[model samples]
Target chain A: MAENTAYDRVKAARANNRPTGKDYINALVDNFLELHGDRRFGDDPAIVGGVGWLGGVAVTVIAIEKGRGAKDRLTRNFGAPNPEGYRKALRLMKQAEKFRRPVVCFVDTSGAYCGIEAEERGQGQAIAENLMEMMTLRTPIISVLVGEGGSGGALALAVADEVWMLENSIYSVISPEGCASILWKDSGKAADAAQSLKLTAQDALDMGIIERVLPEKEMGKEGFYSVLRAELCAKIEELEILPLPELTEMRYRRFRALGAQQLAGE
Target chain B: MPFIDFFNFQPKNELEKGGRQSAPIAQDDNEPAKTCPNCHRQIPLSQLWGNDHCCTNCDYHFRMNSRQRVSFMTDSGSFTELYAGLCADDFLRFPGYPKKLETTRNASRETEAVICGTAKIDGRECCLFVMEPYFMMGSMGVAVGEKITRIFEYAAENSLPVVGCTVSGGARMQEGMLSLMQMAKVSGAVKRHSDAGLLYITLITDPTTGGVTASFAMEGDIILAEPGATIGFAGARVIEQTTRKKLPQGFQTSEFLLSHGFVDAIVPRAQQRKTIGSLLKLHSGGAENG
Candidate 1:
């Protein structure tokens, strides 16, 4: 195999054949019970979140599902959540806090859906509410970037005690094509945009934007699941030991210190 | 008076630029003559500024740059800028981004898109952050985010109220993820300010869309919008394309938002100072002078 460039990894991350959030839940969680509806509005299929057991500890599992087929993709809005989806995710998170269950979110989305209805329903407000609410949630949270973590949509679920990413996953503020179109007036320069964006998991880890990078090199599905499960279990155990106040403070401080390091380097 | 046909609206030319390209405000010749896009009436630039950038003929709200907005809102000679020293570097080293930033700096006469400071709004001291739409559509980048965070932090420390005037296209694409991160960074600061029980107000002007709308702009305790302002997360064209449906008449405008309960009030530019002062006074339990 040739060495993969950033753009190549982006393609790999977006590969339809690659395992999705539902696959991870099936492999990692025990007896997961899927929940739906935001209670304020109807259900949003783009975000799948519910209760499950992670290593004998009941936890809230929320993940963006791109869906399996063309029909499913339409149903899931190609993993781009509407305002209701975010609201649903937040509802589950609040419930998790009430039960003191740890939250484990899998982020994979092109972005929050940018449509007329979505905007009318307060897409920005939904994401904003989550960011503000997640900051002070008493329960611990661990977010994994499973695939395309694009913009505010991904960040809505990613403010956590630990944010991990799959090796090939792409996390960016805007998609390469979008950036290319905006910056160069051409979407064909996506490869160049990818390089400039520094959106690979390795770049994210190096920038202190993410906590860990899970390697998926040459691993079969079973092997990948085992590694992910083990790592997640370890992180959960480590986090569960800390007091709630300390964990919350740590989460707040982690985000607050983000751009300061880069600024210091300059 | 012409019947206000909301459905037959022509999208503001300023918003059509989408913050990527500089609008007509970039002209360096200091041309005194200007035309209102809404009414298509010729007016002197001085008249526009004097009217808080509203068209004299049709009362069309024109986008105000950061300096103009600050000067218009704050008490005379009371603004002490907080983070003027902070500037955006070519963090990603994207091609031509440095040159673009330099050009924008010279053109806008500002280091960054946002001007954050401590100012007196009708004799009430508050921490303020105003976005300059002239500077790359007032896109939120690292510096804009940091400045906003600093303002919130300062407001929290001093127990002062916060008044942010938002006008932006979205996050800066040149800075890539760095620009997007401002949403979270500024949102965190707003959270901290809210937790501190300090009053935080947001005034959406002309156009406030994208990541800025998704973050601090929507998190205000009292959300205010200029009449006729466009406030939404996605651009109108993007929404139209994605939904494959025509948007409703006056969609995303301040009047629409007010009816939908998204905005607390739709303030006309002339009455904004008095309205904001009254809100501050009410919050602070100051004696009502009216």
Candidate 2:
């Protein structure tokens, strides 16, 4: 196998054969109960969130599911959530907070769906509300970027006590093709845009945007699941010891410290 | 210079049909002018300023730049700008971006897109941030995000209310992921501010879209918008192309948002100052410890 460039990594992360949120949920979570609907509107299949047991610890599992095959993708909107999807996730998180259960999220999406109906139904408001609410939700959150983390759609679920990304994943504000189209008026230069975006997992970790990168080398499905489960168990154990006020304050400080370096010199 | 082309050029007819009616054009050597899209009448720059940048003939609200906005909303000489020293570096060194930034800075007479400061609205002290659309469409970049975060921090420290006037195209593409991160950064700041029980009001102006709409702009405690302002996360053209459907007229306008319960109110340009002052007064009774 050839070594992956940033663009190649993006392609691989988005490939249909790659492991998705559903795969991770089935592998790492036991006795999963899938929740549905925002209660205000219909359920969004793109966002699958529910209660589950992770290593015998009750946890709230929320993941963006891109779906398998054409029909599934159509139903899931290719992991690009609508407003209802975010609302559903918010409902699950709030429920988790009430129960004192830790929240785990799998982030993988091209972006939020930008259809006319989504905008009219308050897509931006939905995402913004999630960000605000998640900050003070009074529960530990661990978000893993399993694949493509594009723009605000990804960030909507990514405000966590800990944010990890798969080694092969790529996260950026805009997709490389979108960036190329906007910058050069040519989507063909996506490779160049990918390099400029600095969206690799390693780059994100170095920039303090993400907490850790889970390496994919020589790890079979079972091995990957075991490692992820151990990590989650350890993190939850550590977070469970902290007081709620302290945990929420730490989360707030973590976000407040981002982008301080660039502003320091000035 | 093509004298025959000058004679062939039709002005008012093309202006009426095109959406560039709000665009300022040099009608004469005396004063720059703009055509009111609603009434199709030429309004002089001085007259427009006197009318609070609204059309005198039909009361259509025109977009105001950050300095104009600050001057209009704040008491004279009461605005003390914070984080004016912060500017974006060419981290990516994208082609032509440096030159473009310089050009925009020289043209707009501002260092970055957003102006953050402490100001008074009708004797009520508050922190204010006004986005300048003329400066690269008021795009949020690293510096813009930093400034907004700093303002929120400042407001939280002093326990002052935050009043933001948003007019943005989106995140700046030149800065890549750094620009997009502003959404999270600013939203986090708004969260902190709100957690402190400080009042935060966002005044959505013309053409607020993309990451700005998806973040702090939409997180306001009392979301106010200017009458007839276009506000949405995605542009109408993009949505139309994606959905393959014709949108209803005034789909993303402030009126539409008010009807849809997204905005608390749509204050016209004339009443905006008074409305803001009234809100500040009403909310100013409580102490910082609340």
Candidate 1, residues B1-290, lDDT tens digits: the string is: 25786656666776663754765555445667678888898878877877888898999998778887888998999999887878768877888988998899898898888999999989888999999998988888888888899899999999999999999998887777767777877887888889988899999987899898899889999999998998998889878877889899999999987887788998999999999988888888666773
lDDT per residue for candidate 2 within A68-137, as digits (tens), equals 9999999999999999999999999999999999999999999999887798789989988888888878
The deviation in Å at residue B93 for candidate 1 is 1.1
Clashing residue pairs in candidate 1 are: none
Q: Write the per-residue lDDT of candidate 1 for residues A35-123, one digit (tens) a residue.
A: 99999978999999999888778999999999999999888999999999999999999999999899999999989999877887899
Q: Please give me the total number of clashing residue pairs in predicted model 2.
A: 0
- Note the DockQ of each predicted structure: 0.41, 0.51
Question: Where is model 1 more than 4 Å wrong at Cα?
Answer: A218-220, A264-266, B1-31, B287-290
User: What digit string (tens of lDDT, one per residue) describes model 2 on residues B1-290?
Assistant: 49987767665665555857575665565788899988999899888999999998899998888999999999889999998878877777777788998999899999999999999997789999999999999999988998999999999999999999999988887877767777777887898889888999999999899899999899999999998899998888778877889999889999988888899999988888889988888888866433
C-alpha-based local distance difference test score of model 2:
0.89
CAPRI classification of candidate 1: acceptable
Interface CA root-mean-square deviation for model 2: 1.7
